[model samples]
Target: MQKKSSIFTATHGVMTTEVGVISGELELRTTCNDAGILTLAITYVGAEEWYTLPGEDYRLHDPRDHEVVHRMLTNVLERT
Candidate 1:
């Protein structure tokens, strides 16, 4: 599995598991398994616990697209 993480500030709240919505400095984690399945999670920066992003898991037709997907999500979620 390949896992990537990026830290960003969410000017608008992001919907997440358990916590409902999270804002401010947060970390986005994208995990890709051998089967090209992707799962996304987020957490407060420096926090040990991670929360799953609602409706964020899916299968990628190309595993190499993981990096691009991760970058896009980071940019979109950053807001400003």
Candidate 2:
């Protein structure tokens, strides 16, 4: 079994789970405006994985996911 340990920044408004076997981790971009201020909400979608109870680190058996995630995120960010 594999899991994630960190929230890797996919882009300005998107984020992805890092150090996990499961791939295709994408987050929707949401913005909130209040008092003329804006806040971005990165909502992650797709599969779900759990980490150790006492720790926040996760394991990824398939290291390929990490590379893919980075590539995908970069492409999306560049487009947007």
Candidate 3:
């Protein structure tokens, strides 16, 4: 469930199970499949801006990387 690829134009390729702290501006995009939906969030790490998401499983490639990227984006709306 982990893939290290630069499949994006501006991101290091959205991680499906990544996690990290926010410290800047970020762009996010979430989509849904046949069974469920997936959320993609990117933090600028400079503007401290990120997508509004919470309470879900996530993953990160590097152990030092704590940003949620390639993890399962579930129960996001529940944070409200």
Top-scoring candidate (lDDT): 1
Tell me the tens digit of each residue's lDDT in model 2 across 1-80.
22222344343343234443222444333222222222222333543543212222333344545544444434654343
- Tell me, what's the RMSD of every candidate? 1.2, 15.1, 12.7
- Reference-based lDDT, residue 78, model 1: 92
Q: What is the TM-score of each candidate against the true structure?
A: 0.93, 0.24, 0.27
Q: For candidate 1, lDDT tens digit of each residue in 1-80?
A: 99999999998889986989889999999999878999999999999999988785599999899999999999999976
lDDT of 3: 0.35
Q: How close is candidate 2 to the true structure, as a TM-score?
A: 0.24
Q: What is the lDDT of residue 40 in candidate 3?
A: 48
Of 1 and 3, the candidate ranking higher by lDDT:
1
What residue runs in model 3 are displaced by over 4 Å at the alpha carbon?
Answer: 1-19, 43-80
| Positional deviation of residue 42's Cα in model 1 after best superposition, in angstroms | 0.3
